[model samples]
Target chain A: MSARRIVALSGGVGGAKLADGLMRVLPQDTLTVVVNTGDDFRHLGLHISPDIDTVLYTLCGLANPETGWGRRNETWQFMQALASLGGETWFRLGDADLAMHIERTRRLDSGQKLSSIVADCAHRLGIRAEVLPMTDAPVRTRVDTTEGRLDFQDYFVRRQCAPVVSGLRYDGAARAEPVHSAVAAIRSAAAILICPSNPYLSIAPMLAVPGLRQALRDAEAPVIAVSPLINGAAVKGPTAKIMAELGLPVCAPEIARHYGDLIDGFVLDERDAALADQIDIPVCLADTLMKDIDDRERVARASLAFAERLRAEMIA
Target chain B: MSARRIVALSGGVGGAKLADGLMRVLPQDTLTVVVNTGDDFRHLGLHISPDIDTVLYTLCGLANPETGWGRRNETWQFMQALASLGGETWFRLGDADLAMHIERTRRLDSGQKLSSIVADCAHRLGIRAEVLPMTDAPVRTRVDTTEGRLDFQDYFVRRQCAPVVSGLRYDGAARAEPVHSAVAAIRSAAAILICPSNPYLSIAPMLAVPGLRQALRDAEAPVIAVSPLINGAAVKGPTAKIMAELGLPVCAPEIARHYGDLIDGFVLDERDAALADQIDIPVCLADTLMKDIDDRERVARASLAFAERLRAEMIA
Candidate 1:
C-alpha cells in the first residue's frame, strides 16, 4: 500500500483544530489542508483571510488556545490605537495577527497569488503540512439574511451573526477555479476528511467553487465528514442556527445529508450515537468536542479510522 | 495682536518638537503647522507620512521621547511576526504606529484628502493645533546620490543616509500646489516661522512647490527661519553631511543663506553665535538643541521673539 496521504477541508477555528490534530497524527508531509478563503475580506486596507490564518496558526502552534482563533499572546494595541484614530474597529485586529493581514495584503498587491503566499507563509512558520487556499481567486461568502445580504465578515464578525440567515451565497465561487495545488492534493489523497466546521459557512463555500466539489466527488479516496453538530447543537459558530434556519434537522444525519453522496462515511460525537442508524453511510461515533490537543488527535484518529473502514468495505 | 496667529513650516523630529513647543505656548487655535510630505511613501501598501506623523505624534504628546518618532509605549509584535513571514522589515513600523498608517491608507483609498485625514486624526487624538501636509498632491523627495537617484526613504531609511549626496530633487513639486489651509495659515499669520528642520531635505521640499515659496516671499508677515545647523553640524539627521557634500559650509550662515530673501530673520544656536555676523538677516542666538519639552518651548519662544523683532523692524 502507498503511504497514507490525508487531505482536510477546513474553515477557521473548529476546522483548524481538526486540521492541527490530523497534522499531529499523520506524518509531517502527509497532511494537506485546503482552507476556506470565503471569509477573506479587505478591511482597513488589509487582506484578511480569517480561515487561512486560523488554519496556519493552528497547524504552526500559534493559535490562541482559549479563543480557537487568532495568535496566542496576541495584543489588542493595534485595535486600541485604531479606535483612537476613529478607524473602523468593529472587526478586532490583534497586533500579532495583523502581521498576517498586512503581509498577505502586501504580497497580494505585489501580484503574488494567495495560494503561493499561504504556502510560503506556512513554510516560513515551520509547518511541514501543506496548506493551500481553496482557490487563488476571490470567493466571498455572502450570507443572505433577513436583514438583506450581508458580507461574510459583516454577519460573522461585526453583527455577531445576530440576523437570521435566510440563505447563503458564495459570490464568485462559481467562476473561481480551484487552485491546482489543492486539486492535486485531493486527487492524490489516500483519504479525505471534512473537518467539523460550519457545513454551510465553511465547507459549502469550498464546494461552491467551480470543479472543487466535483473533484472531491471524483477522488478515489474514501471521504469521511466529522459532524460539527453534536446532540442537535453546534460546539462553535452558527452551524446549528444556520441548519435550523434552512429548515433542516440540526443533527449528524442531516449534516451527512448536507454533504450528500460526496462522503463515504461519517464521524459523529458519541452523544449522537443513537442516530447512527439514520445515517445512510457507515458511521463512526467518537467524542468530537476538541477541547484540547488530545481530544483533537482522538477525533482525528477516529475520522481516519472511519475512512479506513469505509475503504475496506468498498474493497470487500 | 490678532491672537498671535502663527504658521510654522516643519519637517520630521526636529521640526515636530518645535511645532509641539509652539503649540504649548501659543493659543490652541493659533498655531498651524505645515509639515513636509516629501518623505511620504507607500510601503507594504500603507501610505506612510513620516514628517506629518512626527508632527502629529509630537504635538499630541504621543511621540516616543527616546526615539523622537513613532508612538510612545509602542509595540513591535507586528514587525516580529512580519519578519517571520519573510516580509520587508527594513523600515521598522511599531504596532501602535501602524494604526495611523493603515487608517490613513484606508482613508486615502476612499478618496479623502490627506489634509482632511490629518485634521480628523489630530482632532480625534485631542490635538487642537492644526496640522497640515504641504500639499494634497504627491511630492516625493528623491536624493541624487553617488549611488544614483534613490527614493527619500530608500536613501534615508534603507541605506541609513550613508551614500554621499550629489543633489536632491522634489519630484512633482514643481506642479504641486500648497494645500489651501496651509496657504491660508501663511497668508493670515502674524508671523511665519520656519522650524529648525533640514533645509535641503525638509523645508526645501515645501518650498519646491510652485506657489508655496512665492507665497512666503510675498506674505505680509515677516518670515523667520530657525537654523537646523549648530557649530558646523546637525543635532540629528544627515543635514550636515548633505550640506558639506553640496560644497556649502555646514554652519548657521549657510542655513540662513539657503533660505535667503524668503526670511527677514534667522535664529541660530548659541554654539554658532560666532558666525552670526555672516548672516545677512537679523540673527537671534539661542540653545536650539531641543533635548526636552522645556528646551523645545524655550527654542520656540526664542523663534517667536525673533519673529516679533523682525516684524517690528519691518514696520520701522
Candidate 2:
C-alpha cells in the first residue's frame, strides 16, 4: 500500500520543528502529530494550550521564525493593555495568539473536544496532516520543586524556570485516556517518531498518559526517538539545566536512558556520535537543531531515513 | 465652597464625549459621571460593559476620536485572526479593547461586583471623576423589532440597526436599584446635565431602574437634557432611524417631550432653535454637534452656562 502512515509526538517550538519536517517529507495524510498539552492552562477565562498553538502555527508556517513560537508579525497591544489593567500577563500571549485561545475556549465551552478543535484549526490553516492532543482530558505538568509544586507556566514563565526541580508529575495523567484519533494514528502507523523535545517537561507527560505508553510498547511499528540533549546541553530551553538540577547526567546517553524501553531506535546529535555505543538502543547521528525551514525539512528527512534503516535492520 | 460638584448622566460614545468635556472643565473630584450599563453583555464568557469602557477610554484620552469609542491606535490583528477561526468579529473589538473585556471578566469571575471593577479600572487609569455604572446588576437593553426581539448589540451592531424598532425594554431594570454613588450624586448636584445621547436607547434604560426616576423628580436640582436629535438627525448611531420607526418625529422637541417632567431645561441645536419654544421646559439653542475637541469643550462650556442660567431661573 502507498499509504505510509507516520505518527510524530511533539511539544512546542523545538518539537514542532521536527513535526514540521516530518510533515514536509511524508505524504499529506501520512502524518499525524500528537501534541503535548502539559503546558495548557486557563488564563483570563480562556483555555490556553501553548504547545498546541505552537504545533499549529509551525505546521501552517504562521509561527515567528525569530521566536520559534507564536504568529509571525504578532502584536503585543493586548498584553500591554492587559498589564495596564493589572491582568496577569506573564505568559506573554500575543494579540493574534489570543484569538486561538478565545476560539478554543468557546469551542470547549460548547462541549467540543480539544482534539476536534485542534483538528479544525489545523484544517483551517491549510494543514493536511492531522493534529491531535495527547488526551481529550485535562492533564497538567507540575514541577515538584524546592519552592513548592508549581503549575507548568507558573514555573516556566512566572518564576522564569529558576526553581530547582526535585521531580515532575503529569497531574491527572492517570485519568487521561489518549484521544481516539491519537491512539488510532499510533496503532496504524508504519513508523512512530518522538520529536527532539524536553524529556521531563514535554514528552514524558504524553508518555505518562495511562494507556498511551503501553500502546506504544505493544505496537507493531518500531518507535524512534531523537535526543533533545546534545553533548551536555539542550539546543533550546532549560532541558539541560533541568536534567542537571535533577542530578541526571546532561548528555545524549542520559536522554536515551530516560526513555528506557519506550524507544526502539534512537538518533543523537553528530557532536555526541562518539557516545552512541553507551546508549542501550540502536542509534544514528545527525544535526538535529532546525534553524531554518530548509533545516527543519532536512532534519525530518534525516530522522525518517534513519528510522527506515533501523526498521530494515530489525526485519533482517 | 471651592468644592463645586457637577453630576452628569451618560451612555457610551456621545455620553463619553460630554463626560470627557466635563472632566476637562471641572476639578477632578468635583465631577461624577453616572454611566448607563444597559449596553453591557457577557461575550466570549467575558463581562463587557461597553459604556463604562467608553467613559474610561474617553477620560484617559485614549479613546479613538474618529469612532468616538474604543482605544486609540488599536490593532485588529486579534479580530482578523478570530474571523479566520470563524469566531464573531462583528463588534470590531481591537486587541487592546479585548484586554479590557478580559480583565473585566477575570475580576467579575473572582466574585467582585461590577461597581468595584469599574472603580478599580478608573483608579488604574487615573480617572478621578467618579465613573459609576447606573446599576451593578446585569441589565440588557432588548429592542422589540419587526424581526423579533434582539439583544442591543445584535440589533445595533450585527444588523447595523437596520431592524425597525417597535419599542425598547430594559430586561432586568424592574429589580435593579440605582448604585448608591449614582443616587447620591443626583441628590447632591446643584444642577444635573444629561449628555447629548439617544433618549430612548441610551437615557431611557438609566431612567428605568427602580426608584431612579422618582429620585430625579424628588431631587432639588434643576435637571437639563442635551438633545441627541439635533435638527432632524442624530449626531451618531440609530436614534433618528429608531424615532422614525417608532412613529416619533425626528426632532429636538420630540426628544424633550420623551423626557417630559424628568428635565427642567433643554439644550438644542441652533438649527432646531425654532422648535425649542414648542416644549414646556426652559430651552437654550447653540452648536451641539461635537465635530472636534474644541467643539466638545465649547459645547461643554455652553451646557454649564445653560445649567447655571436654569439654576438662577429656578431660584427667581
Candidate 3:
C-alpha cells in the first residue's frame, strides 16, 4: 500500500485539478499523470501542448487561478507585441507560458522525445510525481463542425467554440505509438483513475493511442472514473454543450457509459445521486465539484476508496 | 532637393541614432538605410538580426532609452520562465522584443525574403524612411578573437567583448548579393553618409558584401563618413577596445584611414580637429558625440552639409 503506483489519465484544467489533488495525497512520486497531447498544435512555429502545460503548471502551483491554464501573474506583452508585428494572434500565448512551447520546441528540434521533456520539466518544477504525455507522436484532435472541419484551437480559441461539434477525430492517432512509460505505468498500477476531464476531448485521445486501451483493459488494478459533469453540466469548458451537440445525454450515467467495460467503478457527483442506478458500473456518490484544494483532496480520497472497494468485491 | 533620396550605411545604436536624425531632418520617405545583417544568428531556432532590429526600433521611436536596445518597458517573464525550464539564457531576449524574432522566424520559414520582411515591418511600424538589410543572403560576422573564433552575438553579448579581437570575417559575404533595393538606392543616391558605428564589427560587414563596396567606389555621388571615435574613444560599444587590440591608434584619423579610398569626405569630431589634416579625404570638424536627439540632428546636419560641399566641389 505504501508503494502503491496511482496512475491517472488527464486533459487540461479539470483533470489537472484532480491530478494535483492526487499528487498531494498520494505517496511522493507514486502518481503518474498521463496527459493528453491531442490538444497540441504548432502556433507561430512553436509546438504548444495545452493540456500538458496545464498539468505541469497545476502540479507546480504556477497555474493561473482565474483561467486554470497558463502561469499565474503572466504578462501579455508578448501577445501585444506579436500582434503589432502582424504575427498569428488567434491563439494567445502569455509571456510566462510561452517558455514551455519555446523550450519544448527547442528540445524537439534537437531530437528529444516529448515524454522526456515533460519528465524533465516536472522534475525541474519541483513536482515529485511523474507527468507523462500520452504519446510522443503528433495526434491532433480535429473537430467536425457544422461550420466545416476546423483544427482544435481554431474551434476552441479562434471561433470560441461557437460551431457545433458534430464529431471528433484524432488525426494521427491510428499510427501514434503510446509512450512506453505511460503503458508501463498502467500495467503496474495499484489503481487507475480517469480524471474529471472532458470525455470526448481529454480522455479519448489517450484511449486512441495504439496499445494503450489494450494495456488498460488487461491491468490487474481496479479502474475508476470521476465524472466530469455535476448535475447536467460541466464546471469548465464546452463539455456539456458538445455532449448535447453530439446527441448524447449530458449526465454522469452517459459519461460512465462512454468509458464502458474499461472502468470497473464510477464516482458521480452528489447532485446526480438519483441517477447512480442508471450506470451499469459499480458507482459511488461524492461531491465531484472541486472548487478548492480541500474539495479536490476529498474527491480524490473518495475515488481511491471506491477503487479499493471494487477491488475487494472482485477478489470475493 | 525635395526628393533628396539620401542613403545611409548603418549598424546598431550609434548608427540608428544618426539614421533617426536623418529621418527627422530630411524629407519624408527620402532616406534609405542599408543595415548590416552579419550580426544575425539563429538562437533557439529564431532568426535574430540584432542590428536590423536596433535600427527599426530606433526609427520607430520604440527603442529603449536606458539600454539603447530592445523595447521600452519590456518584460523579462519569458527569460525567467525559460531559465526555470533549463533553456539558454545567455542571450537576454525581453518579452516584447521576442515578437520580432518569432515573427521574423515564422516569415523566414514560409519563404519570405529578409528584405521584404523588413519593408513590411517598417511600414507597419509607421516608418516613413526605408530600412533595408545590406544583403538577403546569410552573411554571419565571425570574430577572430584571442580566445578563439566566435559568432557575433557570442562575442558581443555572451562574452561581453572580453575576448581580444585579432581580426573579423563575414562568412558567406563573398557570394552574398546586396539587396536589390539597397543597391538601387546607392546607385540613384544624392549622397552617401556612413554612420558612427564600430568600423570592424558593424560597417565592415556591409562593405564585405560583393557589389556594395564596389558600388560605393563607383557612385557618382560623394561618399562621406562620420567618425565613430571622439576624443580617442567611442561613445558606446567596443570600438576603442577592439581598435587597441587590433594594433591601431584609437583616433578619428585611424577610422578615416580604415575607409581609405571608399570615402570622399570625413566628419572628424571637434576634439580631433588636429587629426583632420592627417586624413587624405576632405574633412569637416564637428561635435560627433550624440547624447540626445538634438546632438544626433546636429551631427547628421553637419555630415549632410559636408556631403553637399563635397558634391558642389566635384561638380565644379
Best by lDDT: 3
The lDDT per prediction is: 0.90, 0.87, 0.92
| lDDT of candidate 2 at residue B203, scale 0 to 100 | 87
Worst 10 residues of 1 chain A by lDDT: A1-10
Per-residue lDDT tens digits for candidate 2, residues B101-176, read 9888888888888888898889899897898998988789999999999999899878989988999999999889
Stretches of model 2 off by over 4 angstroms after superposition: none
Comparing 2 and 3 on lDDT, the stronger one: 3
Could you tell which candidate, 1 or 2, scores higher by TM-score?
1
At residue B159, candidate 3 shows an lDDT of 94
* Runs off by more than 4 Å, candidate 3: none
Q: What is candidate 1's lDDT per residue for B1-316, written digit by digit as tens?
A: 3486899999999999899889888877899999999999999999999999999999888998787679899989999999999989999899999999999999999999999999999999998899999999999999999999999999999999999999999999999989998888888888999998999999999999978888897799999998888888888999999988899877889888888898988888899888989987788989999898899989988888888878887889
Better of 1 and 2 by lDDT: 1
Off-target runs (Cα >4 Å) in candidate 1 are: none
DockQ for all models: 0.89, 0.81, 0.87
Clashing pairs in 2: none
**What lDDT tens digits, residue by residue, belong to model 3 across residues A1-316?**
4578999999999999999999888989999999999989998999999999999999999999898789898999999988898888878889988888989999999999999999999999999899999999899999999999999999998998899999999999888889998889999998899999999988998898867888899999999999999889999999999999999988889999999999999999999999999998788999888889998888888988888888878889
